[model samples]
Target chain A: EDQVTQSPEALRLQEGESSSLNCSYTVSGLRGLFWYRQDPGKGPEFLFTLYSAGEEKEKERLKATLTKKESFLHITAPKPEDSATYLCAVQPGQGAQKLVFGQGTRLTINP
Target chain B: GAGVSQTPSNKVTEKGKYVELRCDPISGHTALYWYRQSLGQGPEFLIYFQGTGAADDSGLPNDRFFAVRPEGSVSTLKIQRTERGDSAVYLCASRMNSNTGELFFGEGSRLTVL
Candidate 1:
């Protein structure tokens, strides 16, 4: 069975603090890994997509790195505005368009 | 709108009642998807439509949950015999193609069954 797990269900960081969130996945064949940021009362906003191990992508203060079995979302000097639930999802290589998602990490940046 | 759109931002109904949720994907987008998000959990895949055909509906929990996209642009998710367990946020997303793997989501419709 394909599964995705995200660790540190919740995290609190002071403004300007940096942290990392983890996403571990088990799939038949790895196709793609995705990261999203979701704010309260809204749907997830797309962040990045990593297709292979050792692949990395960055946007603003966020960077995402991927491995064979895990992915990491690293936040650099996070601001209060950056507080949101970070979601990770994976697509298997079975040609299905469906994506399996992780529970997500709730992040809080206190000023 | 420029992005995907979902109707009935919030819905409250009683158990055993039927409900319909609508989604309008961006123009020219051929791949549309539906997902359900329970409280404090990630969105779970429900169904996927490629153009006017349902490419995959395996994620749907049961027969009571059905979705259709006739014109290939707008889709509707119909839930029959709504249960308290059916209460969740239904999300709709779209992409230009399936290979890209990046989906643009809409503000979901929050469904509450009591």
Candidate 2:
């Protein structure tokens, strides 16, 4: 079965402290991997979508990279406004329409 | 609205009662999806609709759960005999393309059954 696991269920970092959150996944046939940011009392906001191994995408202070077995979300010099739950989801197989998501990493940036 | 919209931002109902959640997608979106998110868990797919037809509903838990997207724009999720286990944030998302398109989500409706 396809599954996604995110590491460091919760993390606390000071402002300007760079760190990375990991998402390990097991899927029969990988199609796409997605990253989202969710704040309290709101729905998730889309971030990046990686389609193949060695693919990388960046937005502002966030950078995402993908490999065969895992993906990493690197946050550089994050501010207090960047604190949110980071989620990783994977779409498996060619004909699949659903995305299997990880539990997410709760990131706290102390300002 | 510029984004997907959900109604009844919060609902508190008794066990065994029925509940309905509504979603309005962005104009001209052909694909709509429903998901449930429990505490500390990722959102789980419940159903998907394409142009007023249910394309996939394998993620729905049981017979108590049903969803419909009539007129290909508005969708509603119906839950019968609600239980405490049904308490969660019901999310609605819409996308322009049926395949390989990113989904835009709404704020979601929080349902609490007691």
| Per-residue accuracy of model 1 over A18-88 as CA lDDT, tens digit each | 99999999998988999999999999999999999999999999999999999999999999999999999
Tens-digit lDDT string for candidate 2 (A23-111) = 99999898899999999989999999999999999999999999999999999999999999999999898688888889999999998
TM-score of 1: 0.98
Instruction: List model 1 lDDT by residue over B1-114, tens digit each.
Output: 899999999999999999999999989999999999999999999999999999999999999999999999999999999999999999999999876669999999999999
Predicted structure with the largest DockQ when compared to the true one: 1
Question: Model 1: clashing residue pairs?
Answer: none
Q: Which ten residues in a row have the lowest lDDT in candidate 2 chain A?
A: A91-100
Instruction: Identify the runs in model 1 with alpha carbons over 4 angstroms from their true place.
Output: none
What shift in Å separates residue B74 of candidate 2 from its native position after superposition? 0.4
Model 2 stretches with alpha carbons more than 4 Å out: none
What's the interface RMS deviation of candidate 1? 0.9
DockQ of 2: 0.81
